[model samples]
Target chain A: MGNRVIKMSTLYLTEQGSILHKTQRRLVIIKNKKIIQEIPIFKIDRILIFGNIQISTQALSFILDSGIICSFFSSQGKFKGSLRPVESGNVFLRIAQYERYLDKEFRVEISKTIVYAKINNEIKFLENYSKTNFKEIIEELKKNINNLKDKNSISSIMGIEGHSTSLYFKGLSLILKNKFLFEKREYHPPKDPANALLSFGYSLITNEIFSLLSGIGFDPYIGFFHELTYNRPSLALDIVEEFRTPVVDKMIVTLINKNIIKEEDFQREENSIYLNNIAKKAFLTHYEKRIQNYREIIKVQCHKLMDSVLNKKIYEPYLED
Target chain B: MGNRVIKMSTLYLTEQGSILHKTQRRLVIIKNKKIIQEIPIFKIDRILIFGNIQISTQALSFILDSGIICSFFSSQGKFKGSLRPVESGNVFLRIAQYERYLDKEFRVEISKTIVYAKINNEIKFLENYSKTNFKEIIEELKKNINNLKDKNSISSIMGIEGHSTSLYFKGLSLILKNKFLFEKREYHPPKDPANALLSFGYSLITNEIFSLLSGIGFDPYIGFFHELTYNRPSLALDIVEEFRTPVVDKMIVTLINKNIIKEEDFQREENSIYLNNIAKKAFLTHYEKRIQNYREIIKVQCHKLMDSVLNKKIYEPYLED
Candidate 1:
């Protein structure tokens, strides 16, 4: 089975002859305003078109034919209409969606969140190590976990992770050398570095959701928690909520910690920052690998949950590590 | 301003010898399948359409031209899609909508609840006289505001009105006979009333709402409290809420007091009750007259807290005797 990743990145259409025109159905790409590449309406699920593009009605007919969708923003940065096909969203599909949202049934939730916290802690340890020879940090933390002479309060454990996330984010900005800045939460359609990581992480989470839904033969578009709006895929939004803090953040932290991608990885545009080609490629490649490298155990478990969804059994998603 | 109502006993038709079609740019109304009427669209404000209707491409073109709207539903049912020329709602509109909901800038914020205990006392005295031997009840109950003076407790006052409302509903139902069995404060929706008189009373409330929204220059569709689902005119729902215990309930009491519309005015159909033409006309005519008659000038003063809604001025609806 193909890797279900919510995270999407553009490869800059290395095929210079290819122009990704967001046709209604499939990725009816054009080059020099002529058809160069055409991913059939049924083949592709999303069309992330960038820059100026012209749309045709025939493409729309295809989009309407396939139960796929694409949301667009014009070059002038105004939201264009969404290309979506209507669906009854079936009874069982809705049940699974509700399961994914309600506590108890969404299993992918906690693992992803915990991974994020652990990565943030590691980042903090690394940053502090750079500033001082702090060799006792992780060792002491490990020892403390092992020696459960007294059970520490959950808040204290969470407090430690929270401090680590803050420390990691601050240290990351310093290492990026003015290339990035962290921001407050609620960053979608990412406004900055923190938001970018959040959106990217969120995308990865959505991939899991899609995979889970697909396993149950359900369309991952209809959703609750997030309302079904005109252009938004409410299901995608629903799946991404718990993962925004974990996977994407961890990936970014890893890249920064290992010094694989440096401060020079991006360039500042007028009101936004653009990832340089090399950085974008490296990020996409790493993203693909991270989702790909997941152990078969997780997949097996997800399949079990999917089975439960299909057979109408309940499976709860993890909320914390 | 034209009456919020465009009344025609029978559906209106265009000069083209077709049935009435309200193909207005902003409001494309189609009744019994014919394009008869058209009006300029509002400046992309809120769209409000009712009745079962269909649309033509030309009417949609007008909507596109005016950038107003052409959202329609299956006739007498729910919203299906946008037809002809409907401009999709913008972000500001969405934000404003969310603000009205989440921020509680709505009429049902509980602050608007009033307790005119003095006036209610008088009404109660009169009702008691007729119900429990007028001469004896009048002697037992004290007259004037002497007893109520200086004993100011908001809850106590509100409680008095609440109790009076119960008595009023019970007494009115008895006069209307076993034709209607109201379950205290149950809401009506097409069905549920025991007889036609109750249904007529409910319908009378709807008509009053339509008029009230018109008189205030407010859109009768985009209101708070009740949710504005795609097809349901939520504004009508909101206006109807406050008037249930006051207007309709009051009118029913008056009718019983005067013996105007009688128990014979009702007829049973299976499990439900409906009014015949005579009863309908009596109710409608009386409703119109009563709405026009203003007795007391009771106002809802929202203290300094509610001043932000409509300045320092209080809300005062015409309470007819």
Candidate 2:
């Protein structure tokens, strides 16, 4: 909103048993009392800490109080949570947001816009894989989008979304050469490598949107499209629907089809699959690249939502051309 | 709301340049690489870190994720901020709270209740010190309470509160053996030892209420009596009003009258006064004792507030008998 461009340097602390220490103005990564890496604190925009990493309270408090976004993830890449600094001083915007959420008509209308954009992005993403014939699946997705227009309640919209997602995943399987590893979409414990990638990518993007929305002073817990779940950033989830295909999904396709990520890159544990450390690094590289490219589009979509809530403007979701 | 009582063991880290390290199930406090103190993590309910104390991220995250409240303070005992865990999953309660805040009549009614309780407690506290004649000031406070019944807005209510507080502190000066040091009330940089104690005590109690209210799922930012300011926990401040006299002021009187804290205990820095390390340790001991004694009363007061918000019950403030 201020037209100030922030250069994002996301520092990932993936090494287990490493300590993040503060030395003067730099963050030093120490392992077994040896300094492994060091970076100036000012250059870092955000920190993504993986499992079992230790950071000094001085460093933790410094980063938090400095207003840097710090998020935590499990070793397997599940989003644990983030340490948010004291909230912004914008109570009026939150009140406006609550008013919109309270209004059923406005809620339904915004949900429709979000669902429409999500399905539209899905179709465009599938269509980009020119080798695959997603004609039947695209028709089904379009039908689901049309079905969304008549859906009144959030549950019904979610029903249509669920149906479209299943079909979209079916379409995705058709496009990937490594289709055997991804027969269907399994969420909780992604049974296969592709599902694992999807879940991880979604978690990363959702965390991004959560930080962005909070920075913009919106209550990310309340949402129109997503149900108000306990401790979930529902509004961020809602906004992230539009970005799934353009940001994460498209990148997932490239990772698989380009052989950028190999089958062996995944490791299986008790029926759940996850990217190995090397594969996660590769995945993050592409993920960060995709995010950089689409960051402006993401900000614009967030602004559109703010306008919808604060100015009674019709919410327009981001759809890839 | 749960009848399960939490035994509060507030672990205060007062040693400057100390590191809080996690050793299996225990927290080890190390100063100059020497173990100064060790406590079982389970035995600790909350941690208060003061000035230059470094904590390992492992310990900080473990404490926070385990729902233990951790607060930070300056070396001179100024409340910096706290690290709160993820919020409770009670969106509906917050919505109800916002609706009440929006209703001008309900807001005004609740503010009156809170202010009435606060002034009543102040009078009772002053009355408790029999060595002083605060009868005229008590009468003036009663007048202020009566004046509150007719006030329709927060600002005018604050006006009454201001006048009553002046009279109350004037009464406080009469009760204190060391009256020359504290002739009047000063807030921002408490000019004298009495003001410093008051500010520090209020901060500790206010933080306690903030954590309690948040744990009960109330948005601590919104309030009835206090004007919504940026990053200030207004609702906590509002609730803390009823606590100021009973919890903080009474303790201040004891500290002064009993010579538990000496005049020389305070350190002066360019017109501002603060409690030194030894005096702070003494103050925290008594503060914790008072909190333990009044914990049930505090919880009941919180429940009364919850009932008022959720059930539209007439909000009754906690008045000292």
Candidate 3:
């Protein structure tokens, strides 16, 4: 007997349509005379609508009740605003989340853990390629991991994280067998397909962690490792740091190397590169498969954080075995 | 551009397993060393577990928050009970639902609507098969539809519903092209594959409507047409009547006639016929496809009901044109 769970799917409403009024708890998608897709709001974590899509107020209410986020983006792949549930989260967790910021020792400890895990996962990923050229970066990552352990300042930890990511991507670029270019992790309107994928994948994972943390009663905007900035979900970024290499980076690399995603998967407009409809679907399918592999990894780490805040258990970051 | 929705899937934990605690807002399904399924709790409507499956306290709490239902049934295919969110539903809607039952005129009005819709949909169904052979049943259905309009008692409406169902199934049996037999609509351990599928399909639709009605703030146990009894979701039953012919019955008949479901798809143990794993999967796939056609139909009717209670809008039962 196996424990079976219902897999929740991300509803990508990329078509130029509008969401009709919800009837019987089902969200209706009408395209002209035909009802394109009818999804139950309960099974959705986020609604990522691209291009000219309109969501009714009723649909948004159900999305909020289901504790999912609705993100709207421009057709040219520019990031827009997201609709989130009203911030009526647990005050106790919120207080604890903010309190950790004032505790310099606590902040350093968590920041060090995130940097260590990120660097460690990068080393593990490069090792999987069996390329001798990556030995330099791997050694560099190892040294950074040790450096991160003694770091007492959040600034120094973030500086090391930035350095390690640069080295990791340089090493990753060498292993990408295809013509898909990855040039230094450019994010805002990515110039290449590879960067576009990395940016898209990161947003997907970040939003996922944001919803999970919020559902667990934490304020998504507060953070200890990452500074709470204007309109930024800093807590999500803090938690997403350790997961970058293993989840999003690895998935994007695999998609490129396996040639499952290609140059044609992108739409070129002026200086920007965006994922075409086919590529978005392919990337999502592959990401879902990849995410399942690390689902426990993400859950376990978050639960440990909750345990630390509520039950006084020590927060342990996810480190590759 | 078309509308898109997230499809809610039913999770059947029939493997005598237990649901682990919720982590990261996603339920962990552990069976031995393997993690079977990790689903977001909000994305699930009902967890149908058959025989010896256990759920943890934490998982139940998440289920309650998401306004979903978890049902348990015997391995012998008998429904045991459902763990619905504690009856903390809107007092206003529940009061309206209960008040309608006390008003005999109100009760008859709603009952007549349900019967009229059920009979009208059946006539529409038979007309799809042939114009010649079903003329008599069509006329009978028309007579029942007219008779239903003037009915003042719940008992007489129930009688008409019963008679119309008999005639509908009789017409259906005539149209079924396969060797698979459909002697009568049987439940409590269906005797044949067709009957088993019909019963199973009906249950799935009924449970769906139950959750939908409950989600819309209606108490599932209260009803107008069907009498509220111990352990019965009478309101769900009352609403399901209008949908049975179009959604469930058509799906079962199509599956059998198209030979998509075979006799081998069932397992016979003494006198009971049960759907085998493969057949169950095929049935669900087709059921989902079939239900999508009427997704709007169900939603529209439920919305009408909600409006009737909240805004005094005339409750319109679904009448197929």
Q: Highest TM-score: give the candidate number.
A: 2
Give the distance in Å from residue A101's predicted Cα in candidate 2 to where it truly belongs.
Answer: 1.2
Q: Is candidate 2 or candidate 3 better by DockQ?
A: 2
TM-score winner, 2 or 3: 2
DockQ of each: 0.03, 0.48, 0.01
True contacts kept of 3: 0.00
**Order of all candidates by lDDT, from best down to worst?**
2, 3, 1
lDDT of 3 by residue, B1-321 (tens): 012114645666655544455677787777774777677766665676555554543465456556566655554344544544422335355445545556788778888888888788888888887647788988888888878867778998899988988888888878876477787778777887778877887887887787678667676666778865544667788889888888888887778878888877778889888877667767766776777778767878887887776665567888777
lDDT of 1 by residue, B162-251 (tens): 554555445445544354455454433334343334445555445444333322322334444444443344545544544454455567
Worst 10 residues of 3 chain B by lDDT: B1-10
For all candidates in order, the CA lDDT equals: 0.41, 0.82, 0.71
Q: What is the TM-score of candidate 2?
A: 0.92
Model 1, runs deviating above 4 Å: A1-27, A73-81, A91-161, A167-321, B1-321
What candidate 2 gets wrong by more than 4 Å, as runs, is A1-7, A32-36, B1-7, B32-34, B131-133
Candidate 2 has an lDDT of 0.82
Quote the positional error of residue B258 for candidate 3 in Å. Answer: 71
TM-score of each prediction: 0.37, 0.92, 0.48
CAPRI-style docking class of model 2 based on DockQ = acceptable
Positional deviation of residue B319's Cα in model 1 after best superposition, in angstroms: 24
